[model samples]
Target: MNKKIINAMLVLGMTAGLAAGTCTSAFAEEAETEEARGYRFTWVNPIVGLEYWSIAEEGMAAADAKYGTDTQTVGPTEINVDEMVKQIDAAVAAQVDGIITMALDPTALGPAIQRAVDAGIPVVCIDTDAPDSARSYYAGTSNYDAGFQAGQTMAEMTDGKAKVGILMGGINASNMVSRVEGFKAALEEYQDMEIIVTEDTNADLLIGTQKAQAMMQTYPEMTAIFGTSSTDAQAAGKVAEEMGITDQYCIIGFDDMEDTLNYIREGVVDATTVQKPYEMGYLGVELLVQTIEGNGPEEQVIDTGVTMVTADNVDSYKE
Candidate 1:
C-alpha cells in the first residue's frame, strides 16, 4: 500500500477518538416533556443471521423503549451489497428520520448514504464506517487500535518470534483493512514475527474455516493466527481444533462470540478483543434521535472502546 493511503487510514482511525465530549445521558433530560415525537429510524445491517447483531439489537431496543423512538432492523440474509443499498433506498424513499447502518464496503454504500443525507435524513454509521460518505457520525471501535492491541499481545505471547497468518472477513472492507494496517504497524518492532498470508472469508463461516485450513496446510510452521472478524476468529479456532493443532498455534480474534469464548476457555484461542456492539447500536439510535430532535450530542465520533478477553476474564463475559 502507498504510504499516503496508510497514513490517511490511520488518520481516519484517529477520528474515532475525537468527539463533542458531551455525555450521552445529558440529552435524555432534554426529551422529558416533548411529545412522543415518535421519530422512526431504520437500522440496516450487512447481514442479520450472525449472533453478533443480537446484542446490538438489544441496545436498539433499550434506546427505543426509553425514548419512544420507532426502530426497525433490516438486512439481507447474506452479504449482498446490492440488497443493502436497496434497503437504504427504501428507507430514504420512506423518509425515515434516521438510518443507522454498517458500511460493508466503503464505496458500495456511498451513493445510498449520500441520498439519505441529501434528503435531510441523518445517517450514522456503526460497527464499520464509510468515512467519505455524508454520514453524520461514526460510533464503533477503533479497529486500528483493536488490531494494534492484538498485535502487541501476540508479540508478548510468542516472544516476538512467531510466524503469523490472518483470517479476514472481507478483504476490501475499510474496517478490515485498517485493522490489518494497525496489526502490521504494531508488529513493525517485532521484526521476527511477520504476517505471512491473508485470506478473505467473505463474511462466511464455512469460507473462513476453509481458508484457515488452507493457511495451516500451506504454512505448517505458522505459530499464530489473527482473525479480523468474529466469524474468522471462531472459524480459525474450529479449524485448529479439528486439526488437533490447538496447542501448536495461538489465535487472537475480534468479537466475543460464544465459540470464541469457548476457544479461549479451552486454551485454543489465546485472546480476543471484544467490541461493544450493544453500545454501538444503543448509542447509534440515541444519537440519531437527538439529531432528529435537534438535541444531538456534540460528539462526532463515539469510541465505544474494547475489552481484551482472555481465559481469566472469559468466564465473566459469558453472562
Candidate 2:
C-alpha cells in the first residue's frame, strides 16, 4: 500500500494544541444570553436535509432550548440558492427578530443578507461566510487555515509529491473557494506537489464519486485527492477502494462524517478536516440574540476553529 501515514506525530501534537488554543466564546458550551425572551430568530440552512447540516440544526436546537429563544429553521431539502434566498426574504417579510444563515454562495446570498440588515434584522452567517454581506457576525471555521493544514497534511501523507485533485461542493461558494486557495498556497511550498484538476460535486455524494473516478481515470498520475466538501473524501476513497487503487492515492476529506471515519479506519481515506458544525450553529444563535438586544460585541467574527483527523487518531474523534 502506497497509502503512507501522514506525520501522525505532528497531527497529534497540533490536534492537542488546537483543542485548547483555538478558544473562542462561540465554542463555549454556552455563549452568554440574557433575556432573549420573545425574540424569534430564523435559521436558514442551505442544505437542510443533508446529514452534515443536521449537526448544525442540532446546535441551533440546543441553543434555542438553553436560551429560551424561538428559532425557526427553514430551507430547501436540497442545496438551492433560489429557495434559500426566498426563505431569507420570507423571514425578513415576517419581521423575525433576527436571522442566521450560511454563505453557500456569497454572490447569491449576499444581497439577501444585506436586505435583511437594511430592513433592521441582525444577520449572522455560520459555518460558511460572506464577508461582503451585511451580516453582523460570522461564527465558524476560518476555512483557508483549515485547507492550509489539509494541504500540509497531504504533503506528509504523500511524501511531498502528489498529483492532486480537489473536489469542491460549489465552485462559487466563497468558503469552499477559500479552502482551495489555501490548499494551493500550502502546496506551493513543495515543488513536486501539483494540482492536476478540480471538480465541483454540488455537495452530492454520488456526483462526487463519479467525478473522483473520472479524475482518476483521466489523471492517471494523480497520487492524492482532496475533498473540500463533506462528501468529497468519501467519494474519492470509495472509488479508490472499489477500483483496487486505494494504495495509489492519499485521500483527504472535509468534516468528520461517520462514513468518512469508517473509511479512515479501513485505510481508504488518509485524513480529514474536522469542523464544528454543532458549535457553529449553537454559537450563531447567541451572536444573533446579542445583536438583537443592542449589545452586539465589537468583534464581528467568532471563529469556531478547525482541526485535522486521521486514521491514527480517528478513534478519539469517534467517541
Candidate 3:
C-alpha cells in the first residue's frame, strides 16, 4: 500500500476508537444518573361519609390524575385523635413522598407530624391545622372567619337581642375552638346577644341532638343556636325541628352538609358558612406536588375561605 493511504487508514481507525470510547462513557454516566422519579402521597381526613370530605376526595383524585402520582386516603372513622396518629405513623413507615392531614387535635398530632418531617418526608395540613406541628403548609378555610360570619348571621337573624346557645363537635379540635372563639367575639359586639350555653357533643349527631334538646329545656328563652361542626349543625337543626321550635329559633351552622342545606331549604337552619373543601383538597395536593418537585414555598398557609349560605342563596349552591 502507498504510505499516504496507509497513514490515512491508521488515523481513521484511531478516530473510530476515540468515538467508541466517548459513546461508552456517555452511556455509563446516564446509567449511573438514573433515579426513581415518581411520588407517593397520603391524604388523611378526620372521617369519611361527610359531604365535605367527599368533596375533598374529588379534588384529591383530580390532582392525582393531573400529576401522574399515586395517592392514598386514610383516616379515623370517627375523628379519633389516636387513630389519626396511628395512620400518620403508618404513612411515615411506608415512606410516602408527602402527607396531607386534617388535625382533629393539633397538639396531639404534633409529635407524629414532626416525626414525618424528621424522616425527610414533606407534610401539609388541610381542612384543619396544627400550627405548632412540623407541617410544611396548611391549606384550608379560616375557621375563625367562618365562625365570625356565623355569629354575625345569627345576630342578624335574631334581631341582635337573642339569647344564644352553641353546639360544638369537640373542644380538642383546634378548628372548632377557633370557630367558637370567633363566634363568641362576634356575638359580643351585640349588647343584647348572649351565649347562654356551650356544649360539646364529641361530634356525634345523636349526642348533639340530646345536648341541644337538654339545653333548650334548660334555657327556655334561647332564641338562636350556633353549630360549629357539620354533625352538630345537623343535630341542632333536627332537634329544633323535632321540638317544634324550628321557626321560633334561628339556627346558624358551619360547613355545608346536605342535611344542613335541606334544613336551610325548610327554614330550620337560618344560615351556614360554607368552606371550599374541594378547593382545600385540590390546593393541598397541588402544593404537595410542587413541594415534591422542589418548586413550592418552604412554608405556606392557604386560606380556602368561607362564605355564608342561607335561604337567600341556597338555590345557587345546590349543585
Model 2, backbone clash pairs (residues 3+ apart or across chains), number: 0
- After superposition, candidate 3 runs with Cα above 4 Å error: 1-37, 297-299
lDDT of 1 by residue, 49-97 (tens): 6777877776676678677788898999777888999999999999899
Worst 10 residues of 1 by lDDT: 14-23
Model 1 / residue 165 / CA error / Å: 0.8
**lDDT (Cα atoms) of all candidates against the true structure:** 0.80, 0.82, 0.77
Could you tell me how far off, in angstroms, the CA of residue 287 lies in candidate 2 after the best superposition?
0.7
Q: Order the candidates by TM-score, highest first — what do you get?
A: 2, 1, 3
Give the per-residue lDDT digits (tens) of candidate 2, residues 202-314: 88999998999999999998889999999999999889989999999899989887889899999999999998777777778877877877875566666667778997788
Error of 3 at 244 (Å): 1.7
Query: Candidate 3 lDDT, tens digit per residue, 126-219?
Result: 8787877778777777788778888888888777999888898887689999999889989888999988999998787888999999998999
lDDT of model 1 at position 75: 91
Task: Report residue 141 deviation for candidate 3 (angstroms).
Answer: 1.0
Off by over 4 Å in 2: 1-36
